[model samples]
Target: MGVLESILRKDGRKFMKRKDSDAGEPGRALEELRGSLYSDFHTSDGAKRQQQRLCGPFVAMTFNFIVAVGIIMANKVVMGMVGFNFPIALSLIHYLTSWFLMAIFKALSLLPASPPSKTTPFSSIFLLGAVMALATGLANVSLQHNSVGFYQMAKIAVTPTIVLAEFMLFSKKVSIQKVITLAVVSIGVAVATVTDLEFNVFGACVALAWIVPSAINKILWSNLQQTGNWTALALMWKTSPITIFFFMSLMPLLDPPGVLSFNWNSNNLFAIVISALFGFLLQWSGALALGATSATSHVVLGQFKTCVIMLGGYIFFNSDPGIVSLSGAVVALCGMSFYTYLNLLGSKESATTSNKLLSKQNSFSQKPKTAEDDVKVEVNTLSSV
Candidate 1:
């Protein structure tokens, strides 16, 4: 509450009293005052649940874009001032160093939580982190073989993999609309890949690897989010150490062991900060959202990431968002929107049915949580090549 706004407690009820000033209309002023809380301050149950439903995947999709775009721009920025001489070594080093910083931040956040039980198994998180690292490495390798289309298709498949993984690992259900959204996004990705129709078998194989761990991580993280209650930073950091381990283990497996060199350049630091800033903001917004409700709903809703970037690239990068790409974005986004709407309806209906069940005094107590408990997991940085 600002000082100029009068505050009063009458009959033990608090009310805001705003004085007339240059504050424009009272409604606008009131909305401005409540700006920070607008997303979560809804008084209606329906609205609150709706946000809960859309929060997870939305954040996940947004995070994916931020990380990808940041890295692309950062690489371009570094090359303009520096050069590719540093790419082979510095890129890898920057990635490792950023992992260390992320881990430090995550550790700081977990300080107040009751110490992680010594017996709690972390093997799954470790293995999943390694999967992400390998998948990312494959993505890096694919960059050398094919055009941008290949990259988009390979990554877009992650959404469907997530849906399937959820069902296999946690018995999650998907509506027809979500299935449609998944297919549309897949088409966008595949069509994007067709930009390089001459992709070789090896390149295609490398590209396909991008989706495997991506989907796996999503499922693992969704489970973790539901049960872990850890901040995104902490979860990321906690799993991050495993990536280092994965890298170390890979050193000897190559023809000539690849070493992760130290590159403590200014550009490296800049990329790290940008990555962390985006990570902090995007994840925090998502956490607030998931606290309210379906991780799956959020993912399906977030495919618009490709659409926004496609438009921006067309405008600034001189590459046209071709009729095909634009149509793909539209089709994909529309399908995702329908998926989101139907999922919300299903959740609300399920909640209502459960409410009725409670009122009936049935033999069995009503089970809570209308939707599957979901976890959202992701790893992206702005420093990768």
Candidate 2:
């Protein structure tokens, strides 16, 4: 009987051990699944951050292209078909609309927080806005006085002008490779767009005059956003009033008389308002692109936009731009693509160089200071002074 009881107890102990082991198997499986899920979540989050960084410039350029093309087409309909001949007045309306939108966005908390307005002086914002307005007004005047081909030529010249202006104003040096690529882009655009060659002293003067302000405007827009940490909406909000003031100041000089006599049909009003909305978008998107990329890149993007517009016109409007023009457009596209690739490569190299510099600095900082090193530092500081 004693042996039987001991055997039963041993079997019971074995049964209990087997049951505990069976329960732990499912527990271990669940823990493994949980760990894997957590790891995947973190990996996905990292991937998303990297994707956003990679897509930042791409998204900005895409927005700029779509809005810019839409605005140009819409303005044609409003000004030519709808007969809203007052370009300056239209510009004023655009400024007002943009300002209104900014206010709404601010109220809705849609725009990201930017540095305080006080950080960027009122004068600087005012100057930027004034230049922006002047650039617009001068462009209109140039277009009015010059042939379309001459106007496009002047527009193409803006790339080099901006490069030269940056070098002169900021001591920024562009690579020779980039310069050559830009030259090709300009020639291609010229070949593609310039058909009629008309020259008037007044037109030539206006076109030349238009270049400086345009360059300054682009540079300031880029600098303020990139360096000042200004959000595009915030900057646009601050500048819109100054822009509106300039448009009002210039309307008398630039806009033809009898604006009030134009037929005020609902269709015309709607078209103009739509164009104004697009104009606001154009301002925002241009600022975004400028902020994301350099001023020169923005100008190149504008040239790309021009090619796309011409092709689109040919496709949608059934207007023939000739095989030569199409070929030029193809060439321009290729040049622009090459320019983008070079820029990306340059950026990677610069980043690597900067990282190396930062590592050297850190290592030097981490090193124990010696009397000799301290003496050398003091001597260098005194020499700098």
So what's the TM-score on candidate 2? 0.78
lDDT tens readout by residue for model 2, 1-385? 9999999999999999999899989999999987765443234333223323544788989998999889988999997999887878888888899999888877875544556566778888989999999998888878878898999999998998899899998899988899899999999999998988797998899899989999999999998877775767767877888899999999998788988888889999999999999999999888888878889999999989989888988999998999989888889989999999999998899999999999999988896989999999999999999
- CA lDDT scores, all candidates in order: 0.56, 0.86
Model 2 root-mean-square deviation: 11.1
**Candidate 2 wrong stretches, greater than 4 Å:** 1-55, 199-201, 315-318, 358-385
Cand. 1 TM to true fold: 0.62
lDDT value, residue 93 of candidate 2: 88
lDDT string for model 1 (224-316, tens) is 555554434445556656765665555344213233353647876676556445434443444343333344544443456556677677778
Model 1 residue 49 distance off true place after TM-score fit, in angstroms: 15
> RMSD per prediction, one decimal?
17.0, 11.1
TM-score, every prediction: 0.62, 0.78
Off by over 4 Å in 1: 1-71, 79-81, 84-120, 251-302, 315-319, 357-385
